[model samples]
Target: MTSKGLFVSFEGIDGSGKSTQARRLADTLTARGHEAVLTREPGGSPGAEEIRALVLQGDPDRWSAETELLLFTAARRDHLERTIRPALAAHRIVICDRFADSTRMYQGLSRGDLRAAVDQLHELMIGQEPDVTILIDMDPAAGLARAKSRQTVEERFEDFGVALQEDMRTGFLALAQEFPDRIRVIDGNRPEEAVARDVLDAVETCLP
Candidate 1:
């Protein structure tokens, strides 16, 4: 990736509209003459996509939390190599729908306590973080309602119900505080246009 490019990620609870906003931001950047590569977690690259099916499909209890962590880390390493890094090396703005932060939140929620392991694994195998992260924050109930409307085969995490979503919101908010320098939490309960504007403004601050 060229030194001039920026790396950005959009993170939030499942139905918080982070993925939509990530796409919108990439479109905005492209309209303004920047090359933005928009991709999603566990499936951004060939190998990663393969891993995504394994983790996102089947029974939610199919894989142990520790085993799940290994799968995600492996996917991330592949994503970085085949997708993110090359885009950044070319100076393109890399806008990821989800990244390592998702791992910390999801695994922590499932296992009750595994965040330390997530961090350690990330540092050891996938050390890079986004130049900026836009976290779409909203009520968990609202987000869960939104999520339930979708028709996806990847229903493993969403099946955890609203209670888990509430816990996930807390986890995401905590992550924002822990990484204040790079994380920006934006209210995502508003219209998509409003959220898109906020996302754009947050990312623009980190751009060259």
Candidate 2:
């Protein structure tokens, strides 16, 4: 079903600051008299939040890649049903920080054939696609360094070593290439405000 509201997603490596840019874009929309719903994947809904904790708790040694993918998909389904869909129906712009794109990147790096997984997920859960997805691109090492410098506590992914982080960045770029029309690649090595401006510009093209 089609709605007046637009669904936009922000995607990037851990320290790319997609969350900050997403919030800024939402604020921009609100200031312009538009309703915007700012949310995130894997924890947007109650059930999703539960799944998020399990997925991010750093059990890669215990969990298989397919298991990880399934968990992520389950969370995404819950998020879609309880949060995204209703907001869209209400004509609110949904600006999501790390949606299916993250799944494609991380899971794709974990396994392979990310396109197939994305298709399966769409068939099973996500009935619609985002109108636009801004990909904040950055060097994995630099991004991870920034993240570590800012954080007081480390997460599973953060502690996964440099190789995995590099894989994730490459995976994201591949996914962006696969969906060029839907994904806008933004250089995230710049200042936060500059990156935010680029994101806003990308979002403007898709907004009504």
Highest TM-score scorer: 1
Stretches of candidate 1 above 4 Å error?
1-4
Per-model CA lDDT versus the true structure: 0.89, 0.82
Pairs in clash, predicted candidate 2? none
Clashes of each: 4, 0
lDDT of 1 by residue, 21-90 (tens): 9989989999999888999998899999999999988887888888989999999999999999988888
Write candidate 2's Cα lDDT for 104-156 as tens digits.
77775645556577668767777677889899888889988877787643366
Superposed by TM-score, candidate 2 places the C-alpha of residue 38 at a distance from the truth, in angstroms, of: 0.5
Q: How do the predictions measure up, each by TM-score? A: 0.96, 0.91
